[model samples]
Target: MATSVNRSCLTYLLHLAQDNLDFRLPEIKALLALRGKSFHPSGDFQEKTPFWCLDGLAEEDVRGVMARSVCAKSAFELWGHGQTHSELRTSLLNYPSENMSPFMHKDSTYRINVYTFNKTLEFPDRIKRIDAMDYLPFEGTVSLKSPQHIFCLLEDYGTDPNDIPEHPNYIYFGRWIADGQRELIRSHSVKNRHFIGNTSMDAGLSFIMANHAKVNENDLVFDPFVGTGSLLVACSHFRAYVCGTDIDYNTIHGRGRSSRKNQKWRGPDENIRANLRQYGTEEMYIDVMISDASKPVWREAPLFDAIITDPPYGIRESTRRTGSHKDVTKHADGIYLESHVPVSQAYHLSDIFTDLLNFSAHHLVVGGRLVYWLPVYRPEYSEETVPLHPCLRILSNCEQTLSSHTSRRLITMEKIRKPEELDGLAQFADGRFSPYQGHNAFREKYFSGLNKRCIKEDNKAVVNGQ
Candidate 1:
């Protein structure tokens, strides 16, 4: 079912003891298959398989099989994945204890790639089983006494009988990462498809969360103002149907490029003419229309599992549009969003952030999540917190300022079943004495306090009878 090159891809799932050994199996299997590794030897393609984690390298390399494994050790591991598994093996055979102690060893023979399909795999602990072999000592000053790496071999006698060169008794987890996986990831890469300079977000953060969001095969994902179609591409990586919309012409063109059977691209980026040549999207055209944000709507569709986007925050792209006949130029006041690349037409989208949020929520499935990024800065304090949605339970003494760009808050929220969940919409007037107010003392009192006018009283998330 796969080309020989891909079939030979050595897929391995390294897990530590007590970790959720089988937790990521299904997703991993799907990801690999989506990536194009549908022909693994593991059969039935079960996850939670255990593999040996060596203790010779750094802990960061060891944690890479886990989510938070992006530490210094993992940096080396990712490097290792592409080349030199044998060199690392040789080092382990010799200096088993350099960081942990001193790695010293002697010549040894035989190298094995193992997979643990049944139980938990922990390094050093399970490695004790090797005691019976009296394996050669680790060479030189780096001895086994202090080992920095950790690992878990799947089983004792599991081996893949193949003509692969170098070592025997070598095992493989599945196959190399699938081609489909790369394409899927690439399709959503913020860097690859960055059509709008400052108006787009990458697939990195969403990809990370999708790994933890507990999604299923048929769930749907939505991205309003879907700049360059990054979120939709990432969602498809998880096998979820994607629905994206945007207001730009190029964005619409790029999104519409692929009209193939493998995909069902819907909304603004729906140019089936170009897409069919490259992918497997549907013949049923994805409906993308140019509607005003203040008044937006989509042909009736199913509710969505998540709402993911990064909207303009007035600062990066000033919400103010300036025109002098010949050409128009706009600017954001340095909104300090770390990954944000400011766009030119920002001035045209000011304070409309609320409208965007309201429209996005209108489509989210109850209990579904809404993830977005915003920029917020407090003049009194230095440094800004990013991805701020996780910490909000209530609002108080909040000042809304047009972004001069110090902090762009990333707001991610879920569409709860009831309005009481987030108090609907709450407003804040800048107090004259407030930090945002600067020195205007007379305006402080009236500008401050609970904003009761914007609160929605209906069971619905908001109200706009029209």
Candidate 2:
């Protein structure tokens, strides 16, 4: 037993939330990268499992990850684990005596918690499970209310809900380290937000986007299509100075219709600034303006540390940009008259992504991140359809299904190089660039799916009448 025990070596176990399964690993990797640590899994590592054992990290590193992770529930310092209860007993008994002695001292007070995944145990059954661990030496006084130390016995019954086994597939014993920032999701929910739009991002996803951007303190984050400033709010929470621009005058100035069911008009203080103030991060609010994304207002050279945004998908809002008629003649000095109103033209989805990538390539500092959403028509979607650029490297692509036939992918990329004059004017013809021209008809595809569904329902109604 002593041969198998090593007091100095330790592993940490992460209990990750089951939802947003695809985003969890990238979020964890990004957070770990913030501390200059790489993820090193112990034994068998499964991405879909709720439980994961991680090696090559200190307790402080685990705490750092928990501080920012919304996808993880809690972390633990692993003592032992095994496939069977008998195997677990052997593993626990072999755990270094020195490592166990410090927490089990007679003067200390501790509690043992029973945590079961995918199954619930009755009171009697839970007590029986706890009582079965009598072989180990725990000299500490049992404290139910306020324990100086907390230990957990976790049982994994596998993921299938309908086919639960009589016993757990695996068992683990560990010391509870820290709980993650899952509460942020509830506290920052869009339903309770001071200001929101019809397509305001959910709180959980907003934070996830910020994480993917690797937002840091004192960083400058920009959102070119900042509708209602949801992304700005998330960046501000991380102590980053947040600013954005929107083509919609109403959205930028917060003068449009209220998104709430009963409210007809927006309140006096219902704006992005008020949102930051609501969360006590108003000091990080840089400012927002009304501008066209195609024509950036920033001066030459890298200006932002990160650019995170969600461009208009034409599903909830119209995609329009400032334009001038070909017949409209310019003045002798090549300027528009003061009385001329800007013409609005349809902003195709293809050009939207092309201009966005070009803007980020030129405006973002090298190594800075660009995180955005790309709408998809499920039947026509493929890896080849995603837009790309020479200077930006794709980091992660995660899909969030909207309906049976429609979905959107969250794309994260990092600016790797500055664009030269020739590269800037390359017209996206390089092998590396896969222009999203095919997606220009996304609006039509989206509505066609809806129309098909409606027709199918109508046919069903007619058949039932017969």
lDDT (C-alpha, whole model) for all candidates: 0.38, 0.90
Which candidate wins on TM-score?
2
Residues 354-449 of candidate 1 have per-residue lDDT tens digits of: 455455445566656665554443443232222112212211111224333233333445554433334342332322211222212211222231
Model 2 lDDT tens row, 216-334? 99999999999999999999999999999998888887887899998999988889999999999999998999899888678889999999999998989988999855666667998
In model 2, the worst 10-residue window by lDDT is: 1-10
Model 2: colliding residue pairs:
none
**Residue 27 in candidate 1 has what lDDT?**
31
Q: Alpha-carbon error at 455 in model 2, in Å?
A: 1.5
On a 0 to 100 scale, what is the lDDT of residue 93 in model 2? 90
Error of 2 at 135 (Å): 1.9
C-alpha RMSD between model 1 and the true structure? 19.4
Where is model 2 more than 4 Å wrong at Cα?
1-9, 329-341, 425-429
